[model samples]
Target: MSLAAQDAAKIPEEIEWTWEVRPAHADAKLPNVLLLGDSITRNYFPEVTQDLTGVANVYLMASSTCVGDPRIEHQIAEFATMEGVRFQVVHFNNGMHGWGYSEAQYKAAFPAFMRTVRALTLESSTLIWASTTPVRIDKEVGPTNARVDERNKIALALITSAKISLDDQHALMMEHRDLYKDDIHFNDAGSKIQGDQAAAQIRAALSMNRLPKAQAR
Candidate 1:
């Protein structure tokens, strides 16, 4: 078995799924932007794409794999290899799923996530870390804001140290508790808010080191 398969056998989950979207850009002229995250990222991807429009060609790689899972890096690597496109900006998040893993496990495995993400920094890719959103639902068995806070804190230290831009979705959603579609996911409005903010951040990063239009692929 492969390393990812071996990792999979170590800790099985209730379910596992991955979703990726790479819109065709025949003779594409716009720079590419990649959004990497879970369902929440998937929710906001459309809005980001719409917001970016002619500015950039947006790509999405959202999965249920959490930071603690060894397979997550493999998933990211495989997705990156499959696309074979230079990402001008990569906005990413995790920490919503993989409830089976302990917070300690999450932190322990987070460095590997950073390593995988940093590999995409080729060609001056601007990296932005989207803080995982809050959990509004009070459930007998589900995510909690306390755990979310801990994970964000752990991630923030690394991101800040690395100088990656931050899109604080958790802090944003904290102000709009009513916008949740469910315990974890957001409503259309919340998603729009997140997407618009994400797009604004991406734009700032892109403008910081504006590649000549001639460099677009």
Candidate 2:
């Protein structure tokens, strides 16, 4: 089985090896886009890929690896070597993995993460930074509400100066709390909405001017 397929088969245990295949530029007929995040991106796979159909070629790869995992550094290294390719977009989030981290740790790691992302893609490509989605915190999987909020704050501050655009995922989830299945993840519908929202943010930032239809009332 393909490495991505193997990763898809089991629940993510460690973030150590998310991508075993090195995606080549020739593999993409459209502009290459990568989705880097936790389970939300995993669950929202279809929607995120579907939404970007004509705009770009979207690649989804995420591990449940939280903010502090040494795995992120590896992922960044994999990304850096792909430079000069036709990559045009990258939508990523790390807060769900970050729930366990202290506020100070998250703050310190935020800029380094952004720098890694910046180094990988050219300035011409747009990087979409999705804020950590709101965690219920009332439940048990991980990450208290306080920590989630603090991480989001740190994420906002770090990306602001780095030319990265924010998705405000935290606000979107809070505005629609019914979407989550637990403290740190969302249901299928929630994932789809999240994907659409991220796509919208990208469109807006790039002046792509192509917004998908609004959710039904």
Which candidate number has the best TM-score? Answer: 1
Q: Each prediction's Cα lDDT score? A: 0.85, 0.65
For candidate 1, list the clashing residue pairs, or say none.
Answer: 28-217
Error of 2 at 189 (Å): 1.8
lDDT of 1 by residue, 1-217 (tens): 4444433443546878899998866238877889999999999999999899888889999999888777898899999899888788999999888877777778777878988988865656789999999987655666888888898999999889888889998989999999999889999999999999999999878876585656632
- Cα error of candidate 2 at position 155, Å: 1.2
List ranges where model 1 is wrong by over 4 Å: 1-9, 211-217
> Model 2, clash count?
2
Quote model 1's TM-score.
0.90
Candidate whose lDDT is highest: 1
